[model samples]
Target: MRIVRRVFVPTLVVVVAVIVGSGIAGGREAFGGAAVGGGLTLAFLGASPGLLDPVAKASPVASLPVALGFFTVKAVAAVAVLMLLLGDDGRGPQLSSRAVAAAMIITALTWVTLHFRALRRVRTPIYDLG
Candidate 1:
């Protein structure tokens, strides 16, 4: 929760910047693409912690496999959806593929950087032998 919140704010800022930049540079299609990109980024990454936390808490050993599986599923689904939307030549109806790709990349980087920084700062006991 705390980590998510910390990352969310900065990610939102980056998303907004990406959207605005795309809109200015590429017009309407790009704007929509940027919006969707940022939204998907938020939806996919934002839901991760909430979905995985319980699994981690209940069975730490299973968490890694679960996370990897979850990620694989997401990636496949996303690719399928994008393929349907973008077609063979990346020509979507009204969405600019470049804008979508750029926004997703920027937001994801922001989320990862913030997440790792926060994780590093967390204080934990060196040993818990009971």
Candidate 2:
């Protein structure tokens, strides 16, 4: 919920703005961005709970392997899902493959950044004075 409010929501705003701007500025490319953004959003949202679940229970060393593995799987799944939804290389009528790629990359990076931010918010003492 906090992640939704703090990260996903804000990222969505930016992605949507890109969609609108691209529509006006880039015309067809806007659809490409929308597809990428929307797909990425769904992919990450679905996977986030599972990823975060292990983070809470495992040591950081242990967590890294799980996180990396899941991240890779999620990324691959995102691409596969987009290919199915958007067609070959994210191209369809009036769609720009480049724009779709750009938006997907942006969405992925934004999600990672937000994940880190959420992790930081977890209350853990580095050095217990007591």
lDDT of 1 by residue, 1-130 (tens): 7889999988998899999999999999999889988888887898889879989999999999999999998888778777876678897899999998999899899999999999999896899898
> TM-score for each prediction?
0.90, 0.65
The sequence of per-residue lDDT tens digits that candidate 2 reaches over residues 1-130 is: 5555577676776677667766777776666666666567646764666566668576666777777778788778877876775687456566676667667677767777876888788786899789
**How many clashes (backbone atoms < 3 Å, residues ≥3 apart in a chain or on different chains) does model 1 have?**
0
Clashing residue pairs in candidate 2 are: none
Clashes (N, CA, C under 3 Å) per candidate: 0, 0
- How close to the true structure is residue 122 of candidate 2, measured as C-alpha lDDT? 77
* Location of the lowest summed lDDT over 10 successive residues in candidate 1: 78-87
| Model 1 residue pairs with clashes | none
Residue 45 C-alpha lDDT in model 1: 93
Q: Which stretches of candidate 2 lie over 4 Å from their true place?
A: 1-4, 58-62, 85-90, 109-124
